[model samples]
Target chain A: MEEVKAKMPRYYLAWAKDDAIRKKGANGGFVTATLVSALETDFIDVALVVKKKSVYEGIPVLTNDPEEIKECSGSLHCVPLNLTKYVVEYAAKKRIGLPTKPCDARGIIEQAKRRQVSLENVYMVGLNCGATLHPLRMREIAAYYGLDPDSVVREEIKEGKIFLVSDEEGKEKEKWMKIDELEEKGYGRRDACKSCVTKIPTMADLACGNWGSNDEKKTFVEVLTDKGETLFKNAVDSGYVAIEEAPGKGIETRQRIDAGMQKRAASWKEKMDALKALSRSERFEFYVGALKNCIHCGACKEVCPVCACEEDAKCTGLYDERDSYAISMYNLVRIFHLMDSCIHCGQCEDVCPVDIPLTLIQRRFSERMQRHLGYTPGMDVTKKPPLYETELGWSAEAE
Target chain B: MAEEEWEPKILAFCCNWCSYAGADAAGLERRQVPPTIRVIRVMCSGRIDPAFVLMGLLEGADAVLVTGCHIGDCHYVNANYKTRNRYEFLKEFVDELGLEPERLWLSWISASEGSLFAEMVREVTEKIKKIGPSPLRREWKK
Candidate 1:
């Protein structure tokens, strides 16, 4: 904490694997204390993240998990866990704060250039992310394994398998398991992570990891940018964070991890290709099946980022108790409404109780949109969709 | 080949400023263009939405033609540019959807080119008549 204060005293976000923090049990009291320290100052305001639906159609606020703050005004927003909310919040607030995650940093950079989110106020604190699983799915998998879903430690992700540690009698036994390995045992993940391309977090000011050492005891935080370099240097000189060059075992361990990831990537390509081969009609049937399993929870649409409706009245009765056909027709229109805007983030699939491959359906359509229109959603904010605007002989390059 | 009926339902979406005027001029001059052509005059060729064009085919139009002003001479500036790129995009889209891309067409016409307008109508009408109504729509009936 002293080290962090001796430095720039800027908003800092840190990402560390659970085990690294668990060695001291209270995460050496760093993460919570950092939040507390930031809250104490009027200059720094911290926002904790909670993801819900666009049903309310406003800033990302989470009503579920409430936290106590000393001085910082913390509000949750019902936005996706991706960098879109971070960027939007930063643009709206016009203040300096730290964001953690590699893709979040990349998303911010891409959005910032389009004036969607400005990076001028962002302090990019990147964590080397192999992937973020849909949290509820993690809980489900843990339950299937007969482990306390909440207690199972998700240690590391390498390619096709996740490495987890479970404690029995104060001793830890590590288990390496694939998603399919889990599925065969009766649990599956949301579809979006199946096609994820980035293994290491990208373009972050600093990158931290848990996979770098055989000892696997320490958080491997690397400064990848000038801002990160300065902050770490200050933090270290002031004793806020302990700093060290990774041991040789750390490098060796990470190499094996990288090789494992490469092997997984090859197999992932085959699985994703098969997933993509499902016809549009077949995918639509999947949606129908999902809706049939509906308790009318309305959670899927609620979490959907581009589903522009607020209340049940706004939703046009897709799920009336008596009218099943109306629901099917309503689902079709909803699919079209978000057909162009969906990023295939799989957040909706995660939120669905029926375990519908909602993300896969979106992926199928988004793939078609790209094939048909050469438009990849979320890549560029400037490209006006061919469907939305009047047809004129406009330059593909809008200059 | 002649045993199969060549009844072309050619949908010509013409811009009001130029192509529509050209079609009117062709009619006034009594040019011998095929009567199979159905001319729908829009505010601008550029004003035609791709969904409308796609829906026209889905509704069983044998051929769809989008006619607008020549480059740099749009009724509204750069409307033709949108028309061109959008048509090209739809062409690709049709190909990907396994529909015949040739069934869709784009051409440039002016208010004064009565002869040219007659020739375009005659040629497109002939091609569509030979190709017949979309098999995709025929399959949809079952």
Candidate 2:
């Protein structure tokens, strides 16, 4: 126990001490308990959590009440909202705690690098994620399973299968389908989630999930940073959570799961990219054709996690409605600006009103530039974006 | 009338400290510079945002030349280095957008290099002439 405490990043199996929280949360409510404990102890001024509205929806809630944090415990697999912007806009100055998926954690880190949020004041309790389904896709899936989409009370993903529970006249019915089988039918996870390789949120303060825990009542938690250790210790000392050292076997199993998910994601990325076969001119036409439908509503820019420029952004400021160019300057400038910094979160695609395939367009442009520069955005905060770097610091060979 | 001989419209961004002076020097000397180029002089090359280049391309400039002071010669001290960095980004952007590599050119011209400035304009004109016309150009009906 002393040796485990001595290490900076320690692994443990933890559960909520409160029976209600233990029963309410997935994987023993370790995250909920920690946030509650932190809020009660004044360690953090606010807790940001996703309040589940339904099996298909969740809304981000920022509260200082410990009970509110307890009420917002469980996971929602279908609601793919990113909480980074909320944290920046609402809780940037306050000491805040929130549950984060890999993309959320990465986005927050990128925002912090851009000086939109202060990292010292934010504590991220990261959840391990395989992928998230679009809410519309979930409804389609529910109908495909012959269940009423509105009647579905609970949804869960476990062991490569998605389980949906529905209640009719107080009688419960359950159905499940394998994720791979459903994906073959062109409906499973969002394109961004399917291609994302960050299965574990190592960039966050702490990473907690159920992949390593054999027991369904406990969470496998890895203390990744000093802030994570403080949060864990506070929860334990305050009698909100109970912890036990994780076994070596559990750790190995978690690593295996992460590796498997990453391998699948890489293959999915290659398979989903339809532009690979097109010649340069064809690719150009494809980009112009896809982006021409943009109404310039600015929804994509509003939800873009990596974009911190807000109202004064050059993309919108310089764009002219009068220019009848093949592609609008708005899109061209945005693509150029995000070439180094795009996290490929697909939020832009999700919010696009014209049904533009921004995920593919952004991925095609930014991914190659990122690969060429050998810089991955949102992974490290100390490394400034390459676009902002000087020639002496970053010299690319002229072609 | 038969279609007039196609001439490329090349837009050049010259810096005030060195490249703009070099353009003036090219006129002072007897060296003949191509009539195909139109120059926009800025305080410094670093001020040339990549967006401006994109705008020039979309506005039907067959080629955009970014001419600046050589490295370590910027009056603002290391500002031209930023131009070099941004030029790299512009290079990748133009290529990915299906523009020919010759459509974008970056060169450093000192205030005294009148012959070099004239030579660059001649070379850029020849390249743009070879490429014909930019696809971004929109033809208006008479």
Candidate 3:
């Protein structure tokens, strides 16, 4: 560990175990403490879909129910367990703080390259996601077990099964619960997360979790970037956490991540195949159907990193005094406006309530972008897009 | 907007010293060609941006035709390279948006190629007419 710390300081660091538990929403009191820390620090401006009770002393905090992140169609301001926009925006504006997950880090990188945010002063905290449960379904499952949704303790998911800790802290935790138990109890997840890829937050600077932990008290934290390393080292030095060499624990966590990724990839392949089989006209119909149910919530657009529209307050282009334009022209314009800039982060899909399958539509367009212009957004900040330049080899008057 | 629409609306963004001169020669020859085309002359084809092509399409033009100096013959040494690459890349980009790639055309008509200029316009006009109007043209917010 010392050798690694000395040699790869630029890309690696160590995280104390406690930081990992807080990432998982493990202890409500601990989570509240961390959330308070996140709130008080002006270093990172946080736009969270948080309960009013979660409010803190200082920070620019945008409040909404965290569950709102699921039904959003246009953009994602928070949720997806990553909180990328908050991390990146705050980092660029203020500097130094943690984003939620790996995917959030990717979103931050994409936004930064577009000059939407700066990456220099951000801490990308990664949570080891087994699978993101559909929020409503999770609530319903809690109800089925005679547990109030608000009273639900830590909900741990592993090996495709869900274990809900509904008892009070002094009560013995419930044993492992099966996905079938939730189903038999009449609860299902949001469709988006059920088909989501990326369980380990691959873009995070520092990923931590307890996916492989036998005890809920200990967490596995692995530093994947210099920024993460610096913060973790500081935390250790400041006596905020206890550090040690947990090589075996680290390997176990990594193996679980690998396994989870394989599962996610398989599911993604199935969803993509289903999407590909749809005709172009049918695909258009799908988007139209999705748009019809839109409540002008602006949740989707709000969460979008590509959505830099300042006029969102008025809902000018996407929403107007008249109903959001009936499907055709408005949607086309909106899609194109985002086409060149969208990073396909899937936040919009994750947030949409109507289950619009936004990621599917964006992926379809991204595929076309790759095939034609040979351009892929969010690949690198330095390389200019092919569309920004002119065609090569052909003369202006070759006819 | 007709299927057999011959209103070429050809946007010839040509370089001043080269393709623009060649365009002048085509007119001076008294060639009986369709006047449906609108030519915008500039100092160099290299000055054009892909955004201009997008703007032209959005503005109801049937086709955007760019003409520049042939390779090794640019007025601003290697200026033609920028034009060549820019248009080629944009051509693919337009196609990806489900737009008719044929609607956006690129060619090299040097100052010496007066006859080529006339022939190119006639050919591009016919091709664009066959393709008809751009979908974005229909959606244009009058």
Candidate 4:
């Protein structure tokens, strides 16, 4: 079998019989072919995929054209964009398909719980994501290694190594660094990515990844929902992809890989929880110290994937700049609102101009609250989060 | 330091059908309520958004009281259930923000429970006094 470039259709752990697509895509171009097939067959009216501008940059493009979908094949490890709000804002009523990282899939499901978007019309092809690089950090890593950051053509992080592959026309330079060494040097995946445990997007319709497969050119796809099955059959019937049954060992391998990634992330989470070492007043001081630098721009709230608030949100509406509170009403109300529904996606921290460690802060506040309530946001829409829950599921006296 | 003694400034939000009428009843019965509390009346306890409690804290109120009719006795029927739900969030949030848990409270005071309202105010004022001025308070000397 040669590189399978998108051409014809077939169904788990299968590669495109066409060599052109299989060679170009990270795995088997199954995701690209599926989206293309979905569009061509009118299964979905639109497909949203990130178009990579560079190793450090990608932008989400909403398109209905199969050729456009085919062109945006390979993934960019540095573009940590969440597509949940985009769907709510742009395609709430349309039949839509999009590739998702775990956070993106979780964010979308959170929006669905809030009734911002209807999950019935959305098809999520969840990509197995170990982690993503911060764009600025990637540039820094490139420059730190004596390479022009702009000249870098491809960046791959695999097996704990950061590989910088630079191609200027026909001239190519490839270098690799241990992720642990880079992290020691304060460069690598974003803190949220380091701490994130959602390696497999079980919340999505179909979970696709290279985790379990021994074949380097094929993808291991798990049909998680009925919608996933519909999508798989649609792509196969439309002749845009061909898949084979995954080998038995592949499933066990995937589980082992997931467990390993989770353990690593758990350690990172433990390491990053700064409040654990602080006294009660010191903890308060630490939070106030970090949050006081806020110019109250509301950028964090704006980019929050799970936040469904608009211009007149509770956070902004009651906040007075002149208030001399130890903490601003904006941060207070925002944190309060997120208590039950924060999916811990880290978009708020990503977009914060002041560089507040919001992922840590949000996780600190929400983790305890969610643990107490026995509620996990974004997993099941039927389970209303504790904030909105009318009856206290647990006794109030339990506190 | 000015050597002037500090007093707790409590901000209480009372629902109109129950707690607000109860506060009025307290006045009618000449109950000795603490002068520390400044009562704000709303038609329903559910009408008090969490922002209001946070705003009170930010406004230098040592304690913010959220009082409504008893659960299942809401004028709107089941609205106080929502209030209780929100109070749970407010309680966790206040604690997490590093404020003394005593600085925030939730209680049910019926329209006829004037003395209970007065007693609750006294209790809140005494507890807040023990905790000292709210850290969020802007010192007059400052």
State candidate 4's TM-score.
Answer: 0.94
Q: Whole-model lDDT for model 3 versus the true structure?
A: 0.56
Total backbone clashes of candidate 4, pairs 3 or more residues apart or in separate chains: 15
**Which candidate comes out best when scored by lDDT?**
2
Residues A1-399, model 1: lDDT tens digits = 446445543222232222333253112323322333333432234434333222112233321121332111211111225644534643435544443554466555545544555555555655544555555566566566566654554344555576666665676666667866875554554346556544455466665555573333345555565655654554444444544556666667655775676566457645655445656445334444655565656676665544434465334453345543412434444454455556566667767777766666666545566555655544443564444555533344311
Residue lDDT tens for model 3, A1-399? 567667643322232234433343342112222223343443234424333221011123443222222112111111244455555444456554543544555566666665766666555556655444545566667676666666565555666576676655566446456764564444544333444455565566666665544445444566666666665555555443554455565576667666766675567546554456665445545555766676556677778765555454323443344532334333344455555556556667777777777776665655565555555555455654443443422344444
lDDT of each: 0.55, 0.91, 0.56, 0.86
Off by over 4 Å in 4: A1-11, A168-171, A322-324, A397-399
How many clashing residue pairs appear in each of the predictions shown? Answer: 22, 0, 40, 15
lDDT of 1 by residue, B16-62 (tens): 99999988889899898887788888998778876667556655677
Residue-level error in angstroms, candidate 2, position A128: 0.8
Best by DockQ: 2
Q: Tell me the deviation in Å of residue A336 in model 4.
A: 1.2
Tens-place lDDT per residue, model 2, A103-159, is 999999999999999999999999999889999999899999988888899999999
DockQ of 3: 0.22
Sorted by DockQ (best first), the order is: 2, 4, 3, 1
Off by over 4 Å in 2: A1-9, A169-171, A392-394, A397-399
- The residue-level lDDT of candidate 2 at A311 comes to 94
